[model samples]
Target chain A: MAIIDSLKKISDTVWELPATYKEGMRVPARIIATEKLVREMDETVYQQISNVATLPGITRYALCMPDGHSGYGFPIGGVAAMDVGEGGVISPGGIGFDINCGMRLLTTNLTLDDVKPHLKEIVDLLFQRVPAGVGSHGFLKLSHSDFRDLVEQGARWCIEHDYGWNEDLELTEENGCIPGADASKISERAIERGYNQVGTLGSGNHYLEVQVARPEDVRDKDLAAKFGITIPNQIVVMFHCGSRGFGHQVATDYLQTFLKVMEPKYGIKILDRELACAPLDSPEGRDYFAAMKCGLNMSFANRQVILHRIREVFSEVFGRSAEDLGMRMVYDVAHNTAKLEKHSVDGKEKTLLVHRKGATRAFGPGHDEVAARYRDIGQPVIIGGSMETGSYLLVGTASGADTFFSTAHGSGRTMSRTKARKQWHGKQLQHDLEARGIYVRSTSWAGLAEEAGPAYKDIDEVIAATELAGISKPVARFTPIGNVKG
Target chain B: MPYQYLEDIGTADIAFEATGRNLPELFSEAADATMNVMIDNLGAIEPHDTRQIELSNDKIDMLLFDFLQDLIYFKDAERLLLRVRDAQIDKKEGKYFLKAEAAGETLDAARHHQRADVKAVTLHNFSVEKENGGWKATVLLDI
Candidate 1:
């Protein structure tokens, strides 16, 4: 592993791959992981991050969180900030294919004990209510103009259509709407592909899981109380998905264009074609950002609508109003996105394009961009683990700002899906999870095999690494009772 | 080589390679490889329907990339799991053009065993090259 010798250990939990390690690097690449965990990492991530450091106008450092692993252009848990004033660039690889792909957590008054007997019924209802898998269609029929409005208005469109409550907006990142979204920048092919998939969970690793938060797992009492997470075994529903094929098409469309224009228009060269990018101030960059915003909005709408469906299921099953059951959103965080923000760099505030691919923002207290209620405590960072292993709820800290306010997105894969499938048969794996008290509901048994729990890194350990690194602080933990996969 | 999925070593996405006697055959095999990433049972997709696609590009690399993107688009938009039944590539006015006919049926999950949902064909490690008497291509898919 290149990490063993080439990178210099900065701290017990941090390592620095110096700019001198590679030929074209303008900035050093920083990684947050212990020596024990770093040994599992191969040279691929070192290459990708160093390559990222070589991009024109890359600011400060190229960073990878504790859960970092090799991915397409950026490592899965990579974070980079570029100076827009100095001709910084934006690449689709930095945002990933599933634009605004994120996790949403909603808390309820009902506890695990209260919902235990009806767990199977609730999961079954969610599976039926929300269409999933490839080609899964939703009843959100929209005309061209309506769809365009959806792309523009985001979750607000669904709330206006009575799909969800207006209050739900307040709990979402960017209030469930990203600015500068222009439907005009979106292609007809992308619109057509997104039309039917607006409210569906399009496959692989995307799921809606019902979980329980025990009093014992609440690490921070005050914060957990603030998040409406109280009582032992409190139930919360969490889902992971994105803009479906709409986002994919948008990324595909831009990447091809970037590749065609990179040399002629930007006078920039990259180590890999997958890292194709244009200056942030250039026409190509602006156009792709506009199109990407549309993807962001579409995903917001998709999740809002899904949340509405989930609330309805709870209301129907428990014979109580959703509000009475305290079915309110805790927070929503987009993992794959690039946002323009003002950050203090080298003691001066600069407008930087922060690209977090498979990483989430962990802005600490007093950031005005965060929700008013959470402004004093910082943004909630949702870290999803495997179905059986449970998940974590962490909060941004003041020290986290060093990495430009970012943290690991999930328990990164320790093994590939192919290997997981080879080792475990889907039916048998399902039975095993059931034996361990997790109900597995998926569109395909074969798909279930690929997501077996043992394939991922230890979630508890990854969370501990981040906390020890002083990037983020853990507040609460969740164990899954039931889950529905696409 | 027809087509085969390479086990992912350092990445989370699916990677595969395809080879054939010519560019046209290589594209067909690549299509098969792409579809196999989604469904293992190609036999389940009966050839009762057909869709024709004509794509033109100055570069062969972009042409193949766009062609693969089209298959994913068709599957999502039309719910059709197509197999390239016929293909022809020609150079017109110094630009490359491809015309192909694909046959398949609407995806019936009960009939077909589905795998990962390939989101898009990625440019990461994507390539097309000539080797021996034939040509080969490598693709990585984001799921």
Candidate 2:
């Protein structure tokens, strides 16, 4: 892997490899990272991003967020908007296996002091109430017909069934349902796999955590107050998950089908087969889009059910109603998704298919998509760090418009899992986190150890890079007090 | 050969490292490792049928994903529990073409110990590279 010597340093935080660096590159590739982080990257990331640059109809720039890492076709943390009217291709790899894999932050009126007395009970209750680990199933068993409806309606299905609050939908991305999900497009095998998995947390970097708000890091006091983070030590719950097997199957089914259809039918020549795609309006592309939407809605419904379960557990433990606990959703945003959005490209508003992989939507203040309540303050971007480190809450910025309003999703892995396991022990890591007053519950000890805090880049540094690059602005930081890993 | 767990990436995810003297043996060992992750027994699968699969990809890593996905598809859709018997990979013009033969039995509760029904093979943390005098690949299957 050779470095593209033609890359020009546009700023301390931005670097660009012009289109001439590779053949068929529709646009230059812009990487948002500090010099130090850029140097630390594996050359595979550059190669992958460069391949992504070569995709047809890519608009503006093939942008890489600060946490960029090598992936199958597009680099993780990759964002690229393709002009649909100009023969753009929609690749399943661009959206990733975990469709709508995202973060949701919930605020609580209880303070750190209030939770300290019940930390053990709360963690236990969450672990018991929430089905986790590999192949875990929930109490909800959907019939084939109901499962299809669930996939089609998304969180609305949950709300209609009294599993979620009506207000929660407004705070969710796309009202927690992307329209045009064709349940009929999904395979029976996919439906079977998803039937019992709803409301369950499948394993691997998926978790539910109890965090203590650090008052010192509150940069937007007014906005924080509006989100019910008024008290300095208010406790909150944040979790990261997605559509599980349903999303995986949707991505898999499309990737294979697209590979079979695109080259023969559309004559689409891809830099990599893993990046197989078709025109957004093409039959194959439209089918994938519809199926991907099903995965997205399924995830929203999954999280909604989990939230209901959380309310139940809180009610049981505190001897108070969930309403009294103030367990209200602040916001839920999808990181891995593709949307047809309007963005200003070359001083003109153009419609493009924006694919965000391992990146969050950072719509700036006053954007109509921003919830009315937070319209003046911008969208709340929850970036989860490693279990041992603290995660940050950032607000979208106007500068993000230049990059299709995207930001890094997490701290991103620094060490390979094999290397991390050989270097650390899960039990010791658990003990170390416990010493720091962060309780952890996981099914596999080795799994816990490999995701040790040190295996990833310092989230603070990543956030600082994003802020310095003007992609997003930090609002507050939350330190982990308790965690439940699948 | 002895078996060893590579690492727990996060949550219920786990990877293992294995080795053999040649490509066929190595691929067979990899298939054994993958099946072990999903079930408890491989010896119990009767060698009643044989299947041949040929796949190609621009990269060896992608070929590995395709191979694993093929196995999972057969297992889920056709109820076939397969073991790779032989494999040949050729790299030309930056692409990998693979021809393989596998043997296994139809799924039967008395013959197989099932763990998790892996829905698909994921590209997450997937790798395949030449090592020593042979080849090695690591794939993350979405279970």
Candidate 3:
């Protein structure tokens, strides 16, 4: 039987894989997707999510969002919350290697009419200013000790250094700096790899795009106006990136540490080596958590600096200061991260370690953690699509607590990069996008070819499923007008 | 080519199978495969700079895993694109030790045709085994 056959339908958009379907499962596995998407999902996602279900102290259900796909230990778009007081285990695999890899959106006063004539110039300048691709380095020059302070301080450091406006921090997740970042727990190699990579857009599905919200794409006019997407053809800038090499090295260093101690020291046996973990309160777990926060801070700082450079680029191009251009931030949301959040479990309030790997936290309205400005409307969720396709701006729904207030991250990959490269020529794709009025600049032809629109699932379909599932509600859809691909 | 990318294994990352006649050869071939994912033209990376790598692990598979991560470390930390020129693997005190010489230059996008920025080596289905009287390793690189 197909794996889909084993899933018991819970709703129009939710399916459940009972714990009995897999041995050693602590809880059932649930996937949030429409019937069509569930059938089209890669077989490995089921296996991987089932593996995730077996981890220690997992609560409720191991959840997979609509954009779920096969990843190493947990399926991309996987969400699992564990009760720390109940011997909950924290796995590096659960948060992913690129810690806090997330999306950021900035609303601009310009419109398509204002930007069309200067699309190429803006994109080209962004491509140059925000270095992209493999071996790309940012313009920042920080000493070893300075780098340590930056990670500990996160985007606040950028504000102090004049890289961002002070108001920007309030709109960012965790006020742009996660607490408990101990540079002492991080490896020197991680610091070395990361100190110079601040502000760079790393390659493989990462991009900096300038988009527009046409009137027709606004699904909820009231909500759209609240989120600053009111102007027809309103131009906005969005980008996806993470901690770069710094996060990768932090995860790698801890993965090695956990592997050496997981079984012998902790007596925890995992089916996959990548699922290696330790108890949340264990010494190894606390150290990794602290180091991981450093990765989170590094990324927050990374995007903060990129936003600074972006403000400069836009200012230089349009002959107006970024402030005069009204480049106010919408919100920044992290897709890959683990956070300690308070949620009601079995009708009792509890602090849970919520792990969202390739998933975004969609905190509903009135949540205490929601930014004060958005507390009434709920947290804004930024879902990035492929460069050829468009993206969406959604707000968390009150009903989203079902999966610990988590939702889909992107129009997740439907094909492999190697296969996409084999199927499309980069130059031709670039020409095609240009003919359609979407201008692009990329560092590698092969990299561009690998991210063709057809290489991913339909963005509209993914959005429709999320809305139908009530995990997040669409506020507006933005069409890409210009992009800088890494 | 001692290595070939596995097209069907991973949809979001790059996976490859590498083979060699001996332990050292296996390590070198895997190193080349990992670097090849980043730079399309591995041969263009001249041996302008060199670094010696020394790592030991109780498990043989992790030894290969560590060696591959070391290559990525150089690319990220030093901007050096290295390929293992030679390697020696030995067993002592129940641990496997690897010592190797790697050579390459700081990455020049104008000279080196870059591809995806490989993030890390994932041990999901990662394996190193003796196959058909030679050594074979299946690896996945997070890009």
Candidate 1 chain A: 10-residue stretch with minimal lDDT: A35-44
**Chain B TM-score by candidate, in order shown:** 0.95, 0.85, 0.98
Best model number under lDDT: 3
- Give one digit per residue, the lDDT tens place, for model 3 in A1-486: 988899999999999999999889999999999998898799999999999999888999999999998899998999999889988989999999999999999999999999999999999999999999996889999999999999999999999999999889999999999999999999999988888999999999899999999999999999988888878899999999999999999999999999989999988888888898998899999999999999999999999999999999999999999999999999999988989999998899998999999999999999989999999999999999999889999999999978999999999888988788899988898999999989999888888998999989988899999999999999999999999999
Ranking by TM-score: 3, 1, 2
Worst 10 residues of 3 chain B by lDDT: B1-10
Model 3 misses residue B67 by how many Å?
A: 0.6
B1-143 per-residue lDDT for model 2 (tens digits): 52355543322234555566665566667777776655457788877898999998886666777777677656643557788888887788888788999998776744565444454665545566677877676655543
Q: What is the lDDT of residue A68 in candidate 1?
A: 87
Q: Residues A1-486, candidate 2, lDDT per residue (tens digit)? A: 357455689999898888887898878898999987787666667777888898878988999999887666787889989999998989987988789988889988899998999998999889888877645667796898999999999999999999989999998999988899999899886776677778877666788999999788787787678776888888999998888777887898888888788878988888766687889989888989999999999999999999889889888988998888898998999988999999998799999999998899999989988999899979989999999888988899988887899999998777765577678887888898888899998755656766788888889889999999988998888999999887
Clashing pairs in 3: none
Q: Comparing 1 and 3 by lDDT, which wins?
A: 3
* DockQ of model 1 vs. true complex: 0.70
Q: Model 3, range B44-88, lDDT digits (tens) per residue?
A: 999999999999999999999989998998998889999888799
lDDT against true structure, model 3: 0.93
Among the numbered candidates, top DockQ falls to 3
DockQ of 2: 0.17
Error of 3 at A341 (Å): 0.5
RMSD of every prediction: 1.2, 5.3, 0.8
Candidates 2 and 3: which is better by lDDT? Answer: 3
